[model samples]
Target: MLIILLLVVFMIGTFFGFMFIKNTIAHWLVGGISFLLLAGSVTMLTMHIRDNWGMKEVTTSTTHQIYTAGDKSAPYGMMIKAEIGKNTDNYVFVYRNNEKSEKADTNFKPDEKHISEAVKKSATYKLVDDTKATVTTKTTRCVWSSDFYKLLFSVGGEQNELVKQNSVVSVPKDTWLVLTQDQVKKLSQEAPAMQKQMEAQLKADPQKAAQLAALQKSNPTEYAKMQVKQIKQLLGITE
Candidate 1:
């Protein structure tokens, strides 16, 4: 409606300005209208670009099931989970907190120059236009970040990471997994990535899989207890 009003105003200004070139009052009125229309259009276009193309901190969370391949020992693989729209009983949203620390003895530079690399190493994700996806959060970041970690961003600013003395490796909490709505949809569709990662791990460490299988087969009663405990933990049922 606002856009339509602007269009009408522009047409009226164009028509009147051309219709009365001899009248000083009418000329000033049309000039003022033209200036306002130009300013409003530029402002609106800037906002539109920022809203659709800019990066947003998606902190709203929803529950979804994870594929652990019956591994009762692994805790929740992700710190938070989300679903597509209103359907909560679906595949878990995948995210990993990757941290790499450098040894104190090693020649390292903890400067702003390396923040871009650090941010890249922190997560694996892609960005997309917000209009391509429909996920939204009613609450702002201040309300949505409760009990959740703040994902840092240094698009053009230098960010400092936490460091500990004498610790050989210092993996600071320098980054978080934040994605736009369309990017999240792109990621959610790649559910097979997690499966492949697990398969690769099993292939690399066959002994671990064999040990789990043997444990499950050798003691069915104990295995049942472990399974029960895992289910309770995943379900957030204390009793």
Candidate 2:
């Protein structure tokens, strides 16, 4: 409709030009209507572009499972690692989406060529101890709300935009380890001391040692995970 209106105005303006050249009254009337249409079109276009006239921001959420990124054992159990950037405040988390998944997923898109700045501005990560089965991500962004207004300002308008996105991951309490790269490296360097401390702690408590022995015999994988979680807590490295 808006496009047709603009086209109609163009035809009227052309007719007005010829009439004006002939010095007639019809040209003045046509010229007035043409001026109004042109002014209105410009104003609507400007408003739609500058103020998002026909759109509203909406937040949508989705949830999915995630698993440990790397080996859980160099220090103790099951682990999820978030690698911290050397020069930036951002952290890169790697995780498998499900038990059957062959590859891990990162926070950014695999096809994205560059995402350092975009992640800093639009993404946030949180770790929670809720024992939930999945991680939830909420994305807030603008979308067209009025079909008529959208048609009116279809040209040169920003149809969609990302405002922000937040990901909240839930893990089992006391059984999951979330650590940074720096901490992982430091823990690796102090592994010998950590092992001695862990051995001493287990020997001094016969009940705890027996419980661990029973758990290891029943579930070796869970035992390794528990050991990792225990070491992480022992070193006070929770990020």
Candidate 3:
């Protein structure tokens, strides 16, 4: 868009320059070509942005799900599962904690892996947009042991693998998967059931539940409060 706008501005300046010099023939030819080029460029840019970014609004009900694993004391802690859709193409999940905000794009393969890791870390996930592919890729760095992990994941058409201290992974178009609104609705509806199942599993294993409860109790109140704030934002309940 910026490029097209610049081109249009340049063409207009050239047209006026020729007109000021009283070059009628030059003005007519250059002006005509400029006009045509401007029109074509604007159309192409508009179409490209629209095709990649335009997404339909969803009007489906949503339900939240919380899960508690049976082996809470295990290295892998309790898992919170929320079903947004079974057949949706793209899904955006955002996480916020302590004035820090993190967004995850599930529209592509890298986003899937990214969100999966976030959820495992007990970060709050919010569905921002549930529509078609908009951006080419999403990138983010991971924080590990209080030090920022120097790796970036780029999700788009071609999937890339990073192995450097600071690496980048690009996902290919064929690997991009977008979910539909109906699928999201279905997942929302089933969330409560999944939660119930997890709760039952916890009940069957009191020791595990106790361990998880202890962990939660030990978590810093500040961090928990931050997560709550993020959750509210994801639900569109907070500004």
Could you tell me every candidate's TM-score relative to the true structure? 0.27, 0.68, 0.26
The per-prediction CA RMSD against the true structure, in angstroms, equals 19.7, 5.0, 18.6
Instruction: Compare the candidates by TM-score and give the number of the best one.
Output: 2
Ten-residue stretch with the least lDDT total in model 2: 72-81
Model 1: worst 10 consecutive residues (lDDT sum): 166-175
Clashes of each: 0, 5, 20
lDDT by residue for model 2 (1-239), tens: 37557756766785666566555666666666676767777777677668877789998898887676555232222333453445443445656666555665675432245463266333334545444335677887778788887676566424557766666666555456566667667767887897788789999998998998898889765785677566767678565
Question: What tens digits encode model 1's per-residue C-alpha lDDT throughout 1-239?
Answer: 24445656776776667576668877877866776785775565465345422233333332222121112233211122333236422222332212221211111222357664422221112223221111221221211122111221113221222121110111111111222345435545654575577579878999977876787779654554554444334344453
Across 195-222, the per-residue lDDT of candidate 3 in tens digits comes to 5876998999999888767766785433
Ranked by TM-score from best down, the candidates are 2, 1, 3
Best by lDDT: 2
How far out, in Å, is residue 31 in model 2?
A: 1.7
The 0-to-1 C-alpha lDDT of every candidate, in the order given, reads 0.37, 0.62, 0.37
Runs in model 3 deviating more than 4 A are: 1-5, 14-18, 53-68, 72-239
TM match of model 1 to true structure: 0.27
Off by over 4 Å in 1: 18-21, 50-58, 64-239
